[model samples]
Target: MEAYVVATACTKFEKKPNQTFKGLTEEVYLDLLREAELENGDLIGQAWFGNCGMGTFGQRNIRGQVCFTPLVNKKLFPERVGIINVEGGCATGSMAFHGAWKDVVSGIEDVSLAIGVEKIFQPDRPDMIQEIYDGGIDQFDKDEWIKFYKDVGDQLGKPFNPEEKKGTIFMNTYGLQALWHMKKFGTTQKQIALAASKNHFHGSLNEKAQYQFKVSVEDVLNDREISYPLTRSMCAPIGDGAAAALICSKKGLKLFTKEVQDRAIKIKSSVLTGGKYRTLDEPGLSRIAAQKAFKQADIIQKDIDILEIHDATSFCEIYQLEMLGFCDDGKGGQFVEEGKTSLDGELPVNLSGGLVSKGHPVGATGLSMVHELSVQLKGEGAKRQSKRHKYALAENGGGVIGFEEAACSVIILQSPF
Candidate 1:
């Protein structure tokens, strides 16, 4: 059985200081059900809840049950619907989609629901952001990361200020890797800023984006520096949000309306893999996963009309361009600088404004990326819709283990006829 995504929805991502996880859940669930045109909740055979805010939310165990109890009525569900919890740093949402996709294709169920929800906004706590991100890395290596941050200034031949850490410790890792790219391929800060400015422009077109305002490359350069060569505008903002997707088997498509069936997106390729311990010269999970996805789908980089990459930082967009085979190894920065990834470019990326403007609620990010792709394929992207719309790709990376992401998932989606 082949799986298809008939419906997708996401809450408007923003810094909701007073919003609870339950509120986000209720909003996405109702919107998703309506979009799928399902009057009966019994159509959902199982659910996968992806989250990473248990430490801050104080519901570590039974997280899926806690959030669903108030929303999903047991009597209305399919017989003994299985509920699974998934957590993979920022890629938690994509992980949930992978689980649901497997269920639909393996004949385990005709239909399944995937939801990624997170609440990182705690106005009373100043350290909530730091504490939440630290969950993705090995807690035992806390001292090691601290020392690395303190010593990075000396290595870069500049004085390091602690306040420059405007976001999570992950920013420091991105900074160091980016600085190395600059030292090797001569990647300029302006190139990174250009990527940020483009995403900001995309955000301005998306009403649901967190930072929905046009930012020029010059504005990004003049913004507060987070880490060396990285400004505050170049980083994803902290916020809370939820996104959900309804996946169905080929046979299950008969149960939906004509409009729903016509708008469904086909899952062409789905690959998930782990990161290996690598030195400075080794490849990362993004490259490995992208290669597998393209081969599995029998598609090339240019075949993808629209794409969304996990841009935790602006420099990440440049690095991912090369890893995803959109350009040569040393030409990733130039790929963006030359407008190759803009809205009207050969390949438009992060047209939903990406994690930088879309807001990374950790768990909800993958689903948000998927949601944007689905909308664009259906010609609902409004101002950001692409002229070329045959295939879409989403690359979501999770956690920070060693030199790269601990896990990564790449999904290839085809527009439904």
Candidate 2:
């Protein structure tokens, strides 16, 4: 009754102001069925839908039913299939995937679908994007985070000023985190830029990436500054897109052709964990989630052949490298700066351009990571394919707590082909 990802599909991550919610959902829905080689949606027993903006856009309750009922009415999807809504800040997609994996592993469903769709681009109302991001942090107790940042600033001898900060508050938080890492680990701004430049190059090779052009380290360093030591190129862009995956049990796999069965990617383990207020010395939630996932998968860090992380900011890529045990506590910067994490390196990271270049549509971001890993494992990555493909890992975190993400999900996948 183990779960396996039989098929995955992702639309180009970009800003689509003219696209309606129904159109966006339908696009990925049909693509998922097509890729899974299903004659109709009736084969799916249950579904988990990930989305984070419908409530902000005015639809609150039953967001999944509201957006999906139209397809069912059109006879494109099944009316009897139950749909579960999921929202976990940026980790929304990961959470949905976790839900479906459990559904199959528990023998409750033979075939389940996990879909993540989002629309956060609004040219008419620029503030809407900010509002969407602001919700990632605690709203009722906003002052808690503000005070936390202020106290950290004093300890680092770099006082913080909210009024003077540019970009989103999350950017400022990342900027401050970068400064702390620099002070403690001798990490340089150039190393952060190197990660950005590398991802930009990887993005250039991916046709579905939002920023499909390569950028140099020098150019990334000189790009418009969002927060000190963090440029625009180092941060994720605003976008809209949808991604879907069909997770099926061993019995369910019999329904697909031999071609799909040959390309199936086994779900080794999937772990979801929460965050809490912790001091600077403590490890973040991603590390905790990763340990549980690694144990469940019965594999160590070195067993991983490739990876995709939630690099919301280039600095996060560095921090997560250390937290995820890819390297020592403070050597993430050095690891990337030395080209050990490039496409040709020992452990190829973020082959999808990551959030920085791939475009992060919060709800869809996590599944997009899943989509990339599945493609590479199946040896279908095309220009971005890695030489190694036995095992792959994805680390996705979302929102913000005192000093880390409010939620995180670590998924380990193994290639059966």
Best model per lDDT: 2
Model 1 deviation from the true structure expressed as Cα RMSD, one decimal place: 2.0
Please give the CA lDDT of all the candidate structures. 0.87, 0.91
CA displacement after TM-score superposition, residue 372 of candidate 2 (Å):
0.3
Off by over 4 Å in 1: 74-79, 143-164
RMSD, one per candidate, in order? 2.0, 1.0
TM-score of 1: 0.95
lDDT of 1 by residue, 1-417 (tens): 578998999999998988888788888988998899876567888899999986576788878777787665644334466789999999899999999999999998888999999998777886876788878887886666555545654666655453555667777778777887888798999999999999999999998999889999999999998877889999998898999999999998888999899999999888898975566547788898999999988999879999999999989899988888888887889999999889999999999999999899999999999999999998899999998888999999988765688899999999984
Error of 2 at 349 (Å): 0.5
Give the worst 10-residue stretch by lDDT in candidate 1: 71-80
Model 1's alpha-carbon lDDT is 0.87
Highest TM-score among the candidates is held by which one?
Answer: 2
